[model samples]
Target chain A: MLYNAFLQAIREIKRNMMRSALTAIGIVIGIASVIAMVNIGKGASASITQSVSKLGSNNLLILPGQTRGGPGGASSFAKPFKPNDLNVLKSSINTLEAVSPVENTSMTVVYKDQNYRTNIKGVNNDYFTVQSLEVDLGRKFEKSELRTGQSACIVGKTVVKKLFAPDENVLGQKIRLKNFSCVIVGTLVEKGANTFGGDQDDLILVPTKMFQRRISGNNNIHMITVSVKKNIPLEEAKLQIDQVLRESRHIKANDEADFTILSFTTLLDTISQITAILTVMLGAVAAISLIVGGVGIMNIMLVSVTERTREIGIRMAVGAMAADILIQFLIESVVLSALGGIVGVLLGLAITYGVAIGLDIQLILDPSITVLSLLFSMLIGVIFGISPARKAANMNPIDALRYE
Target chain B: MIKLAGITKTYGSGEVATQVLKGIDLQIEKGEFVAIMGPSGSGKSTLLNILGALDVPTEGDYSFMDTNIRGLSKDQLALFRRNILGFVFQGFNLLKKTSALANVEMPLIYQGVSAKERHKRALEVLSSVGLQERVDYDPGQLSGGEQQRVAIARAIVTRPKVLIADEPTGNLDTKRSHEIMQLITGFNREGITVVMVTHEEEMAEYASRIIRLRDGMIEKDGHHAV
Candidate 1:
């Protein structure tokens, strides 16, 4: 009996082939977009975590701001920290591993006869260790080179590629930056673009003393990065630095601090939380589309019940139980939904792959999620198909037979 | 054998109450051929529907082979209809999209007969109705006479004990009507009691007895002039 009913359901679906196909299209597109968006979100999240992990977790950045607990709290875009304040923190903190006061300058670099606009950063040798950077060629600046403020520099991989051809050696070459000439002593390893859509390998690095004296002629540093010992807890290290900076700057008790210290791990957590919330909001929007598709299925099933009223009457007249009619309609709805799901999976994967290539991100498809979404669509069919099927099954055979 | 005592059927309610059948008492012995005849609204169709168990009288005791039928549930009546009786309608009532063979096999399927057995029995009955060559043709492709023949084949496919037809020749010409009446008579001769309704006296002559109704009551009951 079940087999016959199943065959009948399939035959009925085939009888209205065009309408059935159109009805399934809605579910297919809805499910496809959901899968593509979810997978892209997952891949983007993984890439972000990996990139943040590359920056040492023990690293922290401190920037000068307005003193808190005055009339108003500190504003984020206020003046930056000065080099003297960084020196005081470096000399006073005992648990600190290294400190680098960083200043940025944009200049047209002249290598031989070719010149290009590049970002130049001035920092001591400790900046490499604090940022967890490795040199691919030559070596980091010598301690004497930083103290004496020599005109020596390390070039990023992008500058190296632009100024020098692949076959030629760029190490030990001289590049002119603004008012002075500097010799390249090493090349930094290739670090790809950062989250803010900037290439990490498009900058030149020189000693802080050289930049303060020769290039910018300024005492203020744009940023200060502090590296703490591995054994020290991050929060404890932050508190100790805060106290030392307060005393060095001569701030009284019950006074707000004069600077903001931010740990890399905390920043990572904040960014990840924001992205997760966005992903959930977007997923909810996709779910609404699926609901719309479910309603479409219900509408079509209702029409189908009306169209087959005579068949229903005949079946009931010949001794089929009411539940049998209900089951047949329910099975047809599920079959339509499942077929839509299968086609939707393929479409979503194709879209994801295309977008991943176009935007250059990873395509990470989770099988568990795909299966769950497919099952959820089938559940939607059953949930939505029941009322219409019951309505059809409950029809009086006498009235149904009389229907034209 | 089937018996009806004080059967009454009415439609609507209150001031517009219209009775379709009233105080109908009738009987048919096993293997007997019977016909019911009346003009439009004379209640012949309503009586036939009640006698076939397709409907229930508003007030009546309907007994089929000594079992009270009016008290049977819809599902029980459906089972009773499938196992012991068959129906032939004026419209032929074959599923339009299916073959004559499949239509003939449908009642047996409801009886839960296996596919091989159903196919064998449907083939046998189709041949008995002279539709052996048209068994695989859909009802839409067949002529009116052939379609009615297929309906007869389906009605007798399960070897039902009683065959009830409502206006079996209402849609056919004289020759086809004669052919259909002949088929019903042959089944009756084979020990399946036949109850048929017709307005034509020629068709009524084939039955062993005739019951005429008027104003929702039986006006005459006797053998036709065959």
Candidate 2:
């Protein structure tokens, strides 16, 4: 009986093909938008984590003072972490792998008249280990050069590509940083962009003394990045470092630590939490469209039941049980929604693919979501279809037959 | 065979109450051709509906082939209708967009007949009704007389124990009416118990027995024995 009803439903849908097509359009658009939103959101979140991980999981940033705001503000005179703080963490914490005090100077780098205004990071040789950067060409600075504060620099891949012609060897080439001439000893590999879409490989790295004595003319460090040993957990290392920094600055247990010890995992978790909230908000908005689509199904089904009153009467008078009548109409609604769901899935794929291509992100189609959407559409049809089908089924045969 | 005793049916309540069928007794044996005659609102249609198991009487004992139809559940009554009874209506009641062949096969579909067997049986019945050439034509494409013939073919194709037709020729002209009556009587001759409701006296005369109804009661039951 069910099989026959299915066949009957197919025939009836074909009978009103135009109406059916129009009815299914709502579901198609709803599912498509949902899929596109979720996938793009996933892609954005994945890219953020990837970019953050590339900057090394062990690194921490210690800005001047305790004021929490954007970069480049006044240092609140609240005893900033000096270069001495790096030495204190290194000597005190056994889990500490490397600590680099970093200072930045804005300089015009001129390589044979190819001048580019860029920020330069001044740090010791241990900066590479602390920041998880790798040399793509030549070699990193030696301990002697960093200790004596030699005027040698490492360029990132973006700088190398911008400063030199394609086939020209940039290593050992003389580049003028401000008034002082520094040779490029190495080129850093491309690290892509940060979460805020800033290029990570667009700057140059120089020895700390050159930036402090020649560029900035100060002994204070703007930020200190620390790396912990691989065997030790980050939380334990953070606690140990916090104690060292507090004691270095002579702050008592009653007083809050002046320096912010941001571990990489915490930052990743924070970003993930924000992304999840956004996803839920966006997904909820998309779900509204699905409900509207379900309403569309219900609306069209009611109209169908109204239009086919005579048909229902005929079926009943010809030995159809009320349940049979109910099944026929119910299956018709299900078939309509199921078809809408199928086409919606395909439409979603196309939309997701186009968005992925246009935005240049990876397209990850989650089949679990597709199946869920399909099932949801079917459920909507069944739930919304019952009242109309019952109305159609329970219609008085005599009155229905007499309907004009 | 069908039997009904003290069948009473009413609609509405209190001052608005309208009794559609009063206490009535009827018996129709197998192979009998019975025509119920009355004017509009005379309860002829209601009696036919009850006999076909399409409606239940408010008070009555209805038995068909020794099974008490009044005690049958809705689904069981639906099964009884599907397996043992067939109906023809004045509107022809053929599925409007479907071919005459499909219309004839509908009852058999309810009987769980296979598609191939259903098509063969539908074609055979359509040919028997003189619609062999128009078997694939939809009801709208056929003439009124042809549509009625198709409806009759649909009715008898199941070879049901009884055929209940309400106003089968009411929507037709005299010539078409004669043709429809001939088709129905021919099926009755083949041993199907035929019960029909009609206001036309000429249509009623064609039956071997004529049962007259007035104000929901049986006025007369006469045999023509032709």
**Candidates' DockQ values?**
0.47, 0.57
- What TM value does chain B of candidate 2 have? 0.98
lDDT of 1 by residue, A280-324 (tens): 887788788888888999999999899889877766655566677
Model 2 over residues B31-150: C-alpha lDDT tens digits?
Answer: 999999987899999898889887788998999878999999777887888889888998888888999998998888878899999999999999998999999899889999999999
- Indicate which candidate wins on DockQ: 2
Tell me the number of clashing residue pairs for each predicted model: 0, 0
Evaluate model 2 with DockQ and give the value: 0.57
Off by over 4 Å in 2: A62-78, A92-95, A105-115, A132-197, A215-217, A253-255
Candidate 2 per-residue C-alpha lDDT over A51-135 given as tens digits, one digit per residue, 9 for 90 to 100: 7787688666666565443333436575666767878877878787888888876778898979888879988777888877888
Interface RMSD of each: 1.7, 1.5
What would the TM-scores of all predictions be?
Answer: 0.87, 0.89
